[model samples]
Target chain A: TNVDASSSNCIFHWKNSSDWIKLNVGGQLFYTSRTTLTNSDPDSMLARMFSTSSNLHPGCIDSNGAFLIDRDPRYFSPLLNYLRSGSLILDPDINPKGVLEEAYFFNIQSCIPLLEPLTIPRDEAPLS
Target chain B: TNVDASSSNCIFHWKNSSDWIKLNVGGQLFYTSRTTLTNSDPDSMLARMFSTSSNLHPGCIDSNGAFLIDRDPRYFSPLLNYLRSGSLILDPDINPKGVLEEAYFFNIQSCIPLLEPLTIPRDEAPLS
Candidate 1:
């Protein structure tokens, strides 16, 4: 039965090539994996876009078939990296407040706490 | 005089949309800018690939019109990031030795010294 199940799994999902996903966020292009999007936050809009049964699946695609997201590319970069590494390090030029807004829009709950601290003014920030 | 020069500059290079370049590196997608590649290392192969007068302009392109570079996507990620920012940070799972080899292949001369320290064995590494 175990051997039969393993063979069935391969048969059901034979197209391994589609695992990589491309996106045209704002004007910048990005490439990531379906596993990263779905596993990062199963409840988020990004996860829903890749979900076959979800209604939020992208309605727009670029000429290259990359999903089009009308969000700032600068903010999206860190968010995507966060999903990949679970680390939310941002470049010095990136405003934390902007990233926080993107996290909220994407509904990446895991990132909110991590970003909130960064958004707080230095004077009011907790002594960590 | 300044206004006349600025207007001629705009006319000569009026197409703003083509500044973004996409690449399919080892089946993974990447989005970057012509400025990033050309400015990173004017003498590097990457810069040559984007040069209009250079023979190395990509001969292979994927179905999505992204330049096809047959290389390890894992190592390419950090290199791309390094080009974007002057920093050479790597994820814990990424090997510095692999990144060094890629930097050499790509002819990114500026990155060699920054990466050499990370590739050295702990005992042989110079103290900061």
Candidate 2:
């Protein structure tokens, strides 16, 4: 979704259409929709970046015309998938610990619960 | 998510732990957990495949140890992602038409709503 620059009252306009919003995560080029990123979590960094009132990164496009983040790309797909759908489908090959790190970095709490089941051991011993 | 083969009463026990269930879609090897597939939609092919009483394809693992399906692998990732998360964040580069086809094949109704906005053009004409 592109921001309407000419409209004085358009509160939620991106610099360009979300299709052009490319992300550089750990040197890997990724593209995503603004609605998908902002709708991920209201308290997330992405939400704040795309918020109408927030001046954090009005136009998150970087020097190379991509939103840059110094984070592991291995777990990004799951994280973005979670944002888009509201559920987390982690790759079996990727360690949950690494994905959790990215979740915390991005403030995606919904995923923490799913990952916790995998990371934390259940108390199988019956208490006396 | 392993099916308790020993327990004659465990209706939902998968033939094996869901983590080991591999899906081979269109000659491409793809892995997925049973929960993700079955939970996608109670009316989907996967739900029937993993249904407790349905004898359709119990223990979906094929001779090669992977669940086989002849479909487009390119859009399968997004379909699996949608199933896991209950939302669809299709790749911007991937045509919505292809993904919609997969969604229909898999019986993911939730995604159809999201994709409809993209596929069906909004009638901008005012009521005459």
Candidate 3:
């Protein structure tokens, strides 16, 4: 398929593949955050972030200090390197539980949609 | 049962009623927040609160701009006054979907337990 970035939806090439899959601009995120590796104190940064941070990361959320953001369950899949090691650039499953709790409270609709299929365990949904 | 506060649970009294059934300090919240609805501007306060507010209210959480905090499902119950009106002290179901979403992510164990019984629609439970 002759696809280009100009359109809201298009086809994109796959690595070492001859065919392209349909891509929707709105279906997925377009931007990514780059947390530069610095010699700064990791402990201090985590503490400061937990106390008060905008997004856990770029697309991450926090629910106090108890829950972290479980961005995508597919990320939890037992395939890629993230399954074995925590060395991925955009591993969304590395936050706290409070953060996820926060998500449940605020965006009930959106949260439900995103969480139900992610195959989250039944014990974690929390009381309404 | 000669219930007492000294116990892990106990019985309490009411200002109007003569007899007391039972009370569990942990079962229900023991404290509340005093916004001190003083001579403060509702607009600016809300702005400041939303942009960088921790806990939309007591026992409240935030997701993002798209969703607010929804504390409890029963809180959404129509009765007493919060149903026909909107003036309560501890309304739980008043947050955002994103907050709930966060809960689904990190604390899938706890989230599923609380959210499931709350009767959230299936469509809302994301593509987990």
Q: List the residue pairs that clash in candidate 1.
A: none
Residue A17 lDDT, candidate 1, scale 0-100: 43
Docking quality tier of model 2: incorrect
lDDT (Cα, tens digit) per residue for candidate 2, span B1-128: 65454634333555344334577564357776667777657887777776565445432223356654544465677888888787778655665666776678777787887876666545853455
The DockQ figures for the candidates are: 0.03, 0.02, 0.01
Stretches of model 1 off by over 4 angstroms after superposition:
A1-61, A64-128, B1-15
Tell me, by lDDT, which candidate is best: 1
Ranking by DockQ: 1, 2, 3
**Candidate 3: tens digits of C-alpha lDDT, residues B11-124:** 323221211111111111111111211112233222223223423321111121111111111222221122123332233533223223333322323233444433465678
lDDT of 3 at A85: 23
lDDT of 1 by residue, B19-66 (tens): 557778888877666666777788888889986566785668888888
Q: How much of the real interface does each model capture, measured as fnat? A: 0.00, 0.00, 0.00
lDDT of 1 by residue, A1-128 (tens): 44333323542364244666888875568988777788878898888888656565343455667765545566688999999898999877566776777788789999999999877879998898
Give the alpha carbon lDDT tens digit for every residue of A51-121 in model 3. Answer: 23324442332332222333442232211111112222122333434334433433323233444444455
Residue A123 displacement in candidate 3 (angstroms): 41
Candidate 2 C-alpha error for residue A77, in Å: 1.6
Error of 1 at B42 (Å): 0.4
For model 1 chain A, give the 10-residue run with minimal summed lDDT: A3-12
